[model samples]
Target: MKTFLLNSALLALTLSLSAVGGPTASPALAAEPTPAAPVAVPTVDVDPALWVVKDADTTIYLFGTVHILKPGMGWFDEAVKTAFDKSDRLVLEMVEPGAGEAQQLFAKYGLDQNGKTLSSKMTEDEKALFTKAMEKVGLPAAAFEPFDPWAAAVTMQVMGLQKGGYDVSSGVETQLTAAAKATKKPILGVETMESQLAIFDTLSQETQVKFLVEASKVVDDMNSSMDAMVALWAKPDPDGLARVMNEGLTDPKLYSALLTNRNANWAAWINEQMKKPGTTFMAVGAGHLSGTTSVPKLLTAYGIDAERVAY
Candidate 1:
C-alpha cells in the first residue's frame, strides 16, 4: 500500500492529477508557462550493455518512467518502443485504469476510527501551516481535516499541480497503458489497490505532519519540478535521480516510508518477475530506478540485474 500512495503522490506531483484531460490537451496545458530551458546537468555515464539484461531466452526491459509530461516533450524514444515490442507483457505498480480507487482508498485511510478529523490529530502550528497551504490550492481548510497530513499534502500537491498546468493525461504510465491496450499485450499489476493504500495507513501522525508542511513549501514550484523531472528523466542518470530525490528528504521518516522502503519492496517483486520465462516491460517512476536503495540496485542485491535501455 505504501507503494500505491508513494506512486500516486509522485505521479500527482510529477505528472498531473487531471487524469481525464487526455493526451492531446495535456501537452497544450503543460506548454502554457513556457518554462525557461533547463540548464544541463552533467550526465552520469553507465554501461549501455548493463542497461539490457538478458537471460537464456527471456529479457526484461526496465524503463524508468516519468508520470507527468509537458507539450512536445518527447520521452518515448525509439529504443523504448523497441524494448516494449520485445516484451510479452506489461507490468506497472498498479493496473487500475483511473485514480478513482486511489481516491476512495485515500478517503478511507484518512479517516480516524473515532470519526474525528485528522486535523484534530495535528499540532496547532501544523494545522495553521496546512490551512494556509490548502487555501493556496483553493481547497477549504475543513475539507482536509478528516484525513492524515501526508494524505492532505499529497492531495494539495495534486491540486496545485493541476492549477499550474500539469495534467495526468500526459503521464507516461497512462500513455503506456493506452499503447499496451492498442497492441493487445497483457498488463499486470504488481500490487493491489488495498495493499497500496495500506502503506499510508501505517504512517505515524507525526510523520504525516512533517510531510504536509514540507509539501506546502514547494507547492508553487511543482511545475518547475515537473519540468526538472522531465529533463532529468530524459538523461536517465541514476546519480542525478538520487540528487533530485534527496531534495524532498526533509522528513526522514516519511522519506523512507514513502520512497526508500517501498523501492526495496518493489525491487523484490521486480526480481521475482525477472526469473519468469517471458519478456516483460516494467514501467515505473524514474525516481524508483535510481539511488543506492532504488529498485535497480535492490534487484542487484537479489542477483537479478536490471539494465537501463537507451532511448
Candidate 2:
C-alpha cells in the first residue's frame, strides 16, 4: 500500500491531510510547514519534457508533474510557459480542494468513527515502531487511530517527504493552478475526490492490513525511497520513471486499479477532448505519462497520435 500511495500519479497531493503538513486539496492530517533546504541544483540545468496531441481544431498539452519539490527547481521554462499561454483550459487529475475540504475528507474517510483503530492491525513491535514514527513526525499516535491503514500509509509517506525538505507549495500543480487562476482560464477535473479516494477506500481489509504492516516496517526508509524517485524525476526520464513507479507494485489488480485502469481512462478522456475545438493544458503526475499504460501509449492503442515535445 505504501508503494501504491507513494507512486500514485498525482493522488498524493490530492489526498494529503493537515497532519502531513499544509492544507491539501486531497485528504491528510495537519502539521505546521517547516523550512526547506536550498535546492542543490540550479533550475537552468533542469528541462522537464512536455508532449502534445493535436488535431485541426483542438490541441492538448500533456505535462507530467511532481507534487512535491524543493524550491528553485527551474522547471517552469519558456516552452512550458508558451504552452500554457496558448491553452484555453487547464485540466488536472482533480480540482485542488478549498480551505476545509481536506478536513472533511479526513472526517469522512480517515476517521475511526466506527471504532476501528490503526493499532488493532499492528504487532507489538510494529505498534512501537509506528508510535515512534508518529512521534518523530510530531504527530500523536492517537491522532492517527482513526485513519485506515491506507490513509495512515499515505500520511507516513507525506511526513517523510516533508521531513526530507520537499515542499508541496513549490510543486508543479500548485504553480500551474495559480497561473491558470491568474489568467482566468477555466479549470477542469478529470476525476472527483471521491472517485480517486475510492481506489484505496475500496481495498480489501486483508490488503489494508498488509499495507499498514509493511508501512510500519519501513517508516524510517521513506526518505530514501522518495530520494530515489526524485532522482529519476529530475532526469525527466520516462522509462526510468516508469520503472520506479512500478517498483513493488507487484499485485496485478492493484497495479491495474492504481495505474493501468486510470491511465486508460485519462487517455480516453483526452481522445474525446480532441474532438472539441480548443487548446487544453493537462498536467498529471509524471508516472502517468510514462510506462506502457501511459496516456500517450494508451491513446496510440486507440489510434490517436501523441508526439513528444522537445525541450
Candidate 3:
C-alpha cells in the first residue's frame, strides 16, 4: 500500500505537470497589448461531467489521464476509445516524440549558478528533512544535489514511481498516441514546449522551496494520495476536485498560477479550434477538465458550450 501510494503521488504530479502547462515564457519578450477581461462563463452544474465535450460535427473526449500507470489499471475505458475512434485528429499537451525538446526547455529554467546545488542552498533542517524523504523513497541524497529543489522533487517522484511499478510506457497518453499514429491521425499540441517550460522559470526562488517542502510531505503518504487520485479520475466529481485543490494543493498562489491561469489560456485556444473545420479528439490531464476553474468552464466564458458525453 505504501508503494502504491508513492506511485500515485508520483502519478498525480505527472498528471499535474502534463496538465498545468510547463513553465512560463522567458522575461525577455516585448510587452504585448492587454486583452479585455474574460466574461463569466456559466458552468453546467453536473457530476461526472468533467471530461467529455461535444457539438454537431466534432466531439472532443477530454480525458483526464494519469501519466504513469500500474499494469491492468484500465484507465482507457471503452467510452474513451470510442471518442478517440470517432475523431479526425488527436491532441495532447505535448506529443512524446517532442518530449526531448521539452526536457531541454526544462533544463533551461532550472538553477544553473556555479557552486549552488539545490542541497547546498537548503537550510540545515530542510536539508535533513529532504535527506530523510529521499532515503524513505530509496534514493541517495547526493543524487539530487545538482538540480534545483523543484526539479529534484519532480525527479525523485518520477524515479520513485518507476521503482514502485507505475510504468510510464503503459500510460494512457502513450497508448493513445500509438493508436493515433497507427491510424494516421493528425496529432497536435495545445502550447509550445518553450511556453510550458516558462511557467516553472517564472516561479520565485522562495516559492520553489515551498514546493519542495510540500512535495516531501506528499512522499510520506504515497498510497493515500494514489487512492485519492484514482477515485477522482474514476469519477471526476467537482467536490472531489475541490477537495484536492483545497487540501492537496499546498500553495494557493502557485496552484492558481500553474493550473487556473493555464486552463484559461488553453480554453481560449480550444475555443478557436472549435471554430475550425475538422473533428479533434483532445486528450489532456483529467484534472484540467474538472473543478469550477477548469477548461470546460472557461470555454463557457467564451460562449462555446462543452457538454459531457456518456461513456
Candidate 4:
C-alpha cells in the first residue's frame, strides 16, 4: 500500500499540472507576416493555444502557460506575438517572484518550527523515499526539514520538472514577462501573491500530506507526464487536456479548491475587465481554461462570450 501510494502521487501531480482550463470556440483572424528575428534562436513548431474575449473596445487575450519547458522550444510564434504586441497590458496569475519574493513568502508560511518536522510526520518508508527523492534532485535533506507538507510538495514539484529537463527560463510566463518588460508595458496580476500561496497554505494537514506524498513519487516518471502535457498543449487540445486533468483527480475537494474555484474567480474577473475598455493579454495555466468548471465555461454561464482565436 505504501508503494502504491508513492506511485499514485506522480499521476496525480501530472494531472494537477494539466488539470485546469475550458473548451474552445472560434472566429478566424488573419496572421500578418512575422517580423525579422532580434537574435538567432532554435525553432520548434508547436502551437499551444489562445482565447480572446472582446467587446467594442476591450479585447483580452487568454493564454495557457506552461511554467517550464526545455530550452529551444519555439512557442513564441507570429500569432502569439501578434496578440501580445496589440495588447496594452500583460496579466499573470501572480507577479514575478524576483528579489527573494518567494523566500520571504516561504519564511512566513512554509516554516513549521513549533510543529513536527517533515520527517517526523512521515512513515519510516515514506521518510526514506522522501530523502532519496530530494537527494536525486540535488536538494539536501536539511533543506526541507522546516517546511510544511504543502510547501515541501510544491518544492518537490518544481524539482521534478527541473529534473525532467524543463527550464524555468523557457516557460511561457518567463518569456511573456520578459517581453512585457522589454516593451515597457505594465504587468498586472489577477490575484495577489499572498492569495495564490494561501491556496495550499490553508489546506488541512491531511490534504497537505496527501499532496506531498504524491509529489514525492513523481521524481522518476515526471518526464513522460510532462511529454503528454506538452503534446496536449502543443495540439491546443483544450477538451482533451480537460478530460485528462479533471478525471485524474479523485478528490473533489482538492480539485475544487485548486482548479475549479480559481477558474470561477478568474472568470468573474474577466467579466469585470470586459466592462472596461482596453486590450489586455491574460495568461494562466492551460488547465484553468478547460473542463466544465473552467474559466471559459464560467464566463459562458455569466453570459459572456470567450472566443478561441483560430491560428
The candidate maximizing TM-score is: 2
RMSD of each: 6.9, 3.6, 11.6, 11.1
Superior by lDDT: candidate 3 or candidate 4: 4
Segments in model 3 whose C-alpha atoms lie over 4 Å from true places: 1-50, 97-103, 236-238
- Please give, for residues 215-294, the per-residue lDDT of candidate 4 as tens digits: 67766665666677677888879888777666446566678777788888999898888889999989988888887888
- Higher TM-score: candidate 3 or 4? 4
lDDT of 2 by residue, 75-105 (tens): 7777888999999999988886653665566
- The sequence of per-residue lDDT tens digits that candidate 3 reaches over residues 41-92 is 4322222333555566655666666666555555454666677787899887
Q: What order do you get sorting by lDDT, best first? A: 2, 4, 1, 3
lDDT of 1 by residue, 1-311 (tens): 11123464445422332343313312322333433544444433322111455689678777776565444445554677777787898888777634555445544664554566767777788777778877777766675555566656666766676667555666677888888999999998776656655676787867666677767766666667766655666655667756776766656675686678878888777667656778888777667777777777777788877665544
- Candidate 4 weakest lDDT stretch, 10 residues: 21-30
Could you tell me how far off, in angstroms, the CA of residue 135 lies in candidate 3 after the best superposition? 1.2
Q: What lDDT does model 4 reach?
A: 0.68
TM-score, predicted candidate 2 vs. hidden true structure:
0.87
Write the number of the candidate with greater lDDT, choosing between 2 and 3: 2
How many clashes show up in model 4? 9
Report lDDT per candidate: 0.62, 0.72, 0.61, 0.68
Using lDDT as the measure, name the better of candidate 1 and candidate 2: 2
